[model samples]
Target: MILPITIYGHPVLRKVAKDIDKDYPELEKFKEDMWQTMYFSDGVGLAAPQVGKSIRMFVIDCSNFADEEPELEGFKKMFVNAKITERTGEEWSMSEGCLSIPGLNEDITRPEHIKIEYYDENWEFHEDEYSGFAARVIQHEYDHLEGILFTDHCAPIKKRLLKGKLTAISKGNFKAKYRFTLAK
Candidate 1:
């Protein structure tokens, strides 16, 4: 579906999301749509707020580009209504960029390992312990479900520098001339 992504400063992006209730008949379909949207937009993760939904949901698939041989199929992963069940003591810093905050990247510190519980595409419960970059991605996407953006963790000087630009971006004062696309 490649739904429009809400940019920085959008009120919905700041609004705390409600948990997904069990009765939503279209939840399965929404998951599929989110996957399609992420693939078409070439994003590693996409949250409900980015797609104009205020529900606590997001999709992630980090299985691309592992093989240069091209003989194997890539893997895909999805996390629905995910919550960090447990986190370890060790922490690491990584540079993260968001689909919503285009052209902005920053280093953020997070737990190096995490245990998460969430439902998969089929709405079945699953739990797994992840470490390294996988853990970092999970923490990043999980924040989106809570109405938290990467900028919220930005350093004070960085925040001050980005303030005006972010405000303009949120107001749509800057027009993106071309959508980012994968090169062949």
Candidate 2:
């Protein structure tokens, strides 16, 4: 199923998510739903909080950028209870967009490398390192688990300038190709 993404200003988006174990209700099903929703919405990454679930889970598929980063070809994975152990390398700026914050894209600065620990769908634990675009996408989705948004990393002036547009988005004034729910 393609879950309804929670729009900006949704309280769930601002709450820190909790870790879930293998026994999380319908864990396997939920993971599939996340992947379906993400692909359906044309998003490279989607976090549990974005779907109104306060859990440390997210999915990423970067195959779309395979031409630019051959290593990312067919790279798809689900991260559960993920934790970033380290962030190294120089920071770089990249334009980022979120399904939860539709119609708004911002140039966000993030580290170029990261070491993280997470469990895959099989419930096996794994610690991995990623770089470049993969690292950026991971960090972006990880922020959702921490109740942080890409816009929060923007310059002060940029944020101020976006206030009106953000408010409009919260009020359902934006158009998105996927289904979403506005804050009550």
Candidate 3:
């Protein structure tokens, strides 16, 4: 079922999510629910906190975007208690937006390449190295697990300028416009 996605000003979005306990048998179901929530929301990624659950787990499906194609074979992935094992090379600037902070995109700098270690649906450890848009999406969701939002990494001036707009949107001032835009 599609879960209600928490908005930017929600406290849960700022809270550091708890690590997923491997012994929890229901995590597989949770992953399924997250996937449904993300797909229904038309989001490329969704973190547990976005659904009001403070857990270090998130789902990613890059296939939804028409412009970007994931180089990896296996597309949809769930990361439980995921961590970045290594990040190397120069940082690259990418325009990023968040499910929590809707309608705003900011240029943020991140490592060009990253190696992430995470547990799959079966609770098996898997390590994947990624770059480009895929890496940016994973890193963005991973930050949610650590109580970090994309705005936290945004350029200071850009973020400051968007503060009022963000607040207004959160207050439902832009609901009508948002609905129309989302319809497209």
Q: lDDT per prediction?
A: 0.75, 0.95, 0.78
Clashing pairs in 3: none
- Candidate 3 residue 20 Cα shift, in angstroms, is 1.7
Q: Please provide TM-scores, in order, for all candidate models, with all chains considered together.
A: 0.84, 0.98, 0.86
Model 2 segments more than 4 A misplaced? none
Top-TM-score candidate index? 2
73, model 2: CA deviation in Å?
1.0
Tens-digit lDDT string for candidate 3 (5-105): 67777777778888767776677677788888787777889999888889889989886553555464456788988998898878999788776777777
Q: How well is each residue in 82-144 modelled by candidate 2, as lDDT tens digits?
A: 999999999999999999888999999999999999999889999999999999999999999
For residue 63, model 1's alpha carbon misses the true position, in angstroms, by: 0.9
TM-score of 2: 0.98
Candidates 1 and 3, the one with greater lDDT: 3
Off by over 4 Å in 3: 23-25, 64-74, 176-184
What pairs collide in candidate 1?
Answer: none
Off-target runs (Cα >4 Å) in candidate 1 are: 65-75, 173-184
RMSD of each: 5.2, 0.6, 4.3
